[model samples]
Target: MTETAIAEHGLIGDLQTSALVGTDGSIDWYCCPRFDSPSVFGALLDEHRGGRFRVCPTGTAYTTRQMYYPDSAVLITRFHAEQGVGEVVDFMPPAGEIATGRHRLVRMLRCVRGRMSFGIEVAPRFDYGRRAHTTDVTESGAVFSAGQLALTLHTVREPEDERLARVRVEDGDMRAGLDLVAGQVRGMILESGADGPPREVRVADFQRLFDETVRYWRSWLARCTYLGRWRQVVARSAITLKLMTYAPTGGLVAAPTMALPEQVGGERNWDYRYTWVRDASFSVYALLALGFSGEAERFGVWLGDRIRERAGGAGGPLNIMYRVDGSTDLKEEILDHWSGYRGSRPVRLGNGAAAQLQLDIYGEALDSVFVGDRAGLEIPYRGWLAIREVLDWLAERWDQPEEGIWETRGGRRPFTYGRLMSWVALDRGIRLAMAHGRPAPLERWTRERDAIYEQVMRQGWNEDRQAFVQHYHTEVLDAALLRMPTVGFVAPRDPRWLSTLDAMDAELVTDSLVYRYNPEASPDGLRGQEGTFSLCTFAYISALARAGRLEHARQVFEKMLTYANHVGLYSEEIALTGEQIGNFPQAFTHLSLIDAALTLDDALDGPTGPATGR
Candidate 1:
């Protein structure tokens, strides 16, 4: 099996889709044209059946290290072998802002020290290995074709070396090996949707593309306004978020890979290559905090379109998630043939949670707009009307029991976090109307917001436990409640919030790694347990900082950073043994990292810093 550790990979993208390049010199996960498309290389989930494109130094006795090229998404994996030192640079050219079906991935290899032998394996099982493909080996490179999908591989060398240029196709796959001296280089370009065989290429062309890609990323990062204590980590998270963003639709995928189990051998694996309203809304705050106003504005426009369309059912104005293109055609299905990551069975595609009635999304939606508006993101008059209509509808049914933020399939409940966010929706709606002088039902919205606040205070709290429970029914603590102070639903120093924080600290915080909720105490209609959620841990850090626990927050923050993989990336969750075990390089984790960094920076800067309010 392609059993690379999840944390040993770095990410690179063209703003439309991305690939996970493991430090072992294998691109184990990738999707073409778009993030949600069927994988062309998915060895991350299955070994023999799922395909992979691997370029590594010959022999297994070499130490490998991976890192991003400074502030850019270009990933470099270096090999330290007894014979010599070599490195592979991997990157995707930015696809710009338009939607297209073409993409290019470039891999450049250089022998930095003495002569070293390298091997190339191109095994692409298209359609997730369901479809057979034909590979044609050529004198220069190779072409792999399967039905409508076609991939052309181009190879070029720095100097004419006939001995290192021969490649062959074996068992429907492409394979080659090269032995290069120091200062020699090899370039391989894999292009998707190739109309014809690639023409002759030169090493100079590859160098030009490499330089241009580096400049593209460095230029984009220049707009970051964060100059605080954790600038490097904050910047890394920002770049990760940018890499996950689909530029054409301004929608950020939750993460790039799917069916990577939260718990090893558990059945909780799910696809995350779609946009969640709740996650993107939080991303709005993080982006604006980093002074990436352009990104926040684009997402505001994308969300406004969702609001105007109103394509959801009883869950208010928007679906909990959608495709990067804003389409609601996600049909959850199982790939019964392909094995899941580490044998976590029943690998799934698409997401059934798209139709879930997560009422908290309304608040997250409006909160994003509100955050963006504060940064000069203006809503058109028609968009404002849609927001008003959504609020009016939510006003009547804000108290209805529905799925919470976790999308638990155990059935709906009047989740405290859902109600908290519903209150946020109305409260922000009222603020926006007053600030912009827009027409809105102020009386009804105010009444409903107050009612939600009062109801949560009364029914959602456990007087015996002296903490706010997950919902009104149980006394169990949830990390989601830690968001109360950040959204202004409750003051940071409020006694009730402090008690809830203390309760969470006692129950949910294990060495600063936070769990969303206890599955044993509160079953989620799923089999087996999950890891400590990375997003929840970062959110916990933010909450801790806001609650004036700066020392504890800093310690937890540093410890959490240690959990990040080799190249400073985090997955959806961390195993009890500290291995990342979910979707690799999740956007929610990075967004919360940015949020936590900003909050902690402000808290540590004392009273002379920017306002800590969201």
Candidate 2:
């Protein structure tokens, strides 16, 4: 397989799970059944050991390009060779309301202008390439089986044609080739965990599924309420967020691919296939802003369950993150046998940061539920009581310090952002109780909230630097503090905030890209360094816009959009070289983009009204 750049890929998924298909015509990274499940194809991390399903034109020198079927998750990768032009359309049918332990990935090949020969390979590496698998190739397709995982690949063509008849098995993998002329087509459908004979799909069946899938995506996107500027980009981000959601439980994973490095040949790699409270809570606000109340309401129920499970128990109100099914057994493990992306070693599965103490989550959780409630998602009495219990639990322990939002392994300090969130948690909880006339302890919560405000103003501020430091001990600026204005903790144009923004502009912001924090000044117990955070950059744009710097904000936002990949997708971070790194199609980045776009649009319209009367 040709080496593919991380930015040269498009994403496709059912509501349950997603796959990353490269411009090179390879399904390089995919997890079966669920986003957190083991990989059926993972060549993005290790090209040799990590298996992949590749279908590309062979014996031809070609340049490739990729794009989404407009307003849909269906991805098309087009190949242009000396003799002809061909393309592959990839998609996964929507799982809809029912939750299942099975999934299907379809790839259709077409020669639009001339003749081209295509080669196909199916290699399955179960359990992160730690387990072996056996393959059976028949005339029609192939079946691959491991201990508990089975995948069947079906061929689709005209009954009278011989498009996929050249099947051969080699070294536990399946390989085949086919030739097609202009106006001819062939298809492949790979389904997970099927019983009895493999399901045979003809050309007509492929066309039916394709039409249904396209309709499903277009119909779903029609519900978006964002009619402001950047409509196309906002719609794409919304679709990406929906694709990351596990429809069964209404849980959203942070990203589909894991262990993509923050820095090439660096150890700053971690898994992001679990839901973080901070990420999901912010997602609720983004979804609600776009009129996606159903998603917000469902996430509210999922979050309410977490609170109820721990309302009367020990530990904090919630873990920093959780698995898709609301299970907390995310024990981190390292794949020592496989080489990491670009040799960034110790490719890890499961996030160890889930067990850390991050006080900011309370603020995020309460803020989400509060937003959902305001959007007409009613909080049942029992759920309200559980939320009250969580506030009560949080009120007692808001003072202490743990790892901050960055989840650094460095020892904890008095993180100012954490304190800001602690204040938000109490303030929102008190407002919820008062607005709905629910029973609660408002006096104690209000007192604590006021005290937290005082404490942050005093200790979190550094008089000499004229900026709020990352923590009490150091005079370092952090991009995470850009949310101070967005969360209502401080005014965007307040003298202090403007000064802090100026400080960050001098230190953290580079050509409009913002770094999370300077690790050189505040060593984060981790080796090497990282790139500018895409989420932080978007937040910076929001802060700029809210501060009445509309022209500058528009400039920064436009520049940031240029960093997005060809299909308007972003990874977690952007390398200094201007390429996307870290996990692909990150929810945090997309959500923040949506927020920034809305904020900028509102700012550009001024006090009269929105430009589109939205």
Candidate 3:
């Protein structure tokens, strides 16, 4: 059996949920109904235990290539062999509440030229493959069942190329694809329906749904605000992030699937399929800044709800992260039954990091709230109170040590970036209070902010190293500090900060990719070596541009773009060997890219690249 890893796949979603489509034309991971839903396609975890749906050209000699439609979310995969070329374009429409059946993964194929052969393997293991599945094939495709979960796939005509690959039975070649003709209708139930979801779909019915999916996506893109040199790349990344968003609650999962290792056969693997308060906050600025306030506003609403719910709790602020639907009951567990991705052991399902105190998220959460408030995204009066309440709570608890931004398993320490962002939380709150004339503890907040600033400068900096260390008294450098200027904490060119920047360049820069911190220097409580952080690399570009090193920064930014996967997607980290590490198409990385690109464009065009209305 051919094996596929999660990070090796490209993600395509319809804004409500997403699926991991492997390079070889198999969907290895996906969740139905929502981003945090149980796996309907779990092949990424254990190719043997977890199931998958694949359509591939016959012949081991066949080479595979893939790309996304320019400026759109449609993904096309081509298989080339001596016999001929076969292609598959996979996608789902982005409209809400369509035909609404069990979620679908529509595949279409086309013979590019001479006769070719292909195969289809529709084996689905529901509920993380803890149960057995029964497959029922019909005229269209097949319906897969295991327990209460049901996932039905729809295909057309006689799919005779068993395993979806075989040359002998073909007159021409396998020619099919998820409809992308702009008017094809496509939608899925995502939940088991009456009679346990229809076993298959009619060809005409599938065609209509496919057309609808295309129209839905096109209409949504019409509202995109990006018009940059990398417009197609940026817009598609934006859409990918949006598609991964769970619509009902406005929560965006960090990534669509779980257990995609950060390193090949390494223990750096962890699940990323949940809403991160920090990531959501950053996403607002990215979307709103790029003229997609619709997305930002949606996220803002979700954040507000979360803030309100958490305010009503004993902690008086919030949990660091939550399930897409705001469930705070994520208990991390290992699926010992299935082998991990790439033989990386301890495949985690729910994230234990949730229980860790990542204080940085409070500031991040408030950052978006502040921005959304300014951009006229309305907050309920009570919701506004909740936001202020969190700020007030932060005013007191900001100095506490917790898990740093990397969500390290290491014992919590005083992360300087966490402190820097705490300052941002207070700064923005103070501004909101003063500007809106809202009742607030401004005097206390200002004093607190000033005191925090004084403390950060005094201890957070290591005079000998001439750089702000990751923690007080430690000589470690952290890439998270690359946001020092972006968050308005300090001038990029301050002599001391400049010295710090130089120190970071010397200590942390590896071929222009920035490491979060030298793991060798600061053990993050994990054993495996990590890759250069993509987010930090982009931040380095932003920092360089801020320091007026535009040529160097622009070069770095351009080169960083080279690291993106073929579909213009990026994971959280880029391995030293150029493999994407961490989660596939991380939102934080893409947003930072947007920030870096915008900053560089401003340096080049004097803030006149393209105006995305506030």
**Candidate 2 per-residue lDDT over residues 87-164, each given as its tens digit:** 999999998756787789999999999889999988878888988888887766778988878898888888788847
Q: For candidate 1, report its TM-score.
A: 0.98
User: Which stretches of model 3 miss by more than 4 angstroms?
Assistant: 5-7, 95-101, 158-207, 607-614
Tell me the TM-score of each prediction against the true structure: 0.98, 0.98, 0.90
Compose the digit string of candidate 1's lDDT tens values, residues 1-614. 44788888899999999999988889999898899999999989998788899998886479988889998999999999998999999999999899888888899988999888889899998888888999987766788889888889887764455534447777799888988889987878899866678644688898999999999999999999999999999999999999999999899999998999988898888999999998888889888888899898888888888888873345567888999999999899999998788788889898998888888889989888888888888888888898998998899888888989988889999899999999999999999999999999899999999999999999989999899999999988889888888888888888998888988988888988999999899988998998899999999998888888898999999999999888899999989898999898899999999988988988899874325346
Question: Alpha-carbon error at 45 in model 3, in Å?
Answer: 2.6
RMSD of 1: 1.5
Tens-digit lDDT string for candidate 3 (292-335): 88778878877888888777465647887899878888888888
**What CA RMSD would you report for each candidate?**
1.5, 2.0, 4.9
lDDT at 311, model 3 = 75
Better of 1 and 2 by lDDT: 2
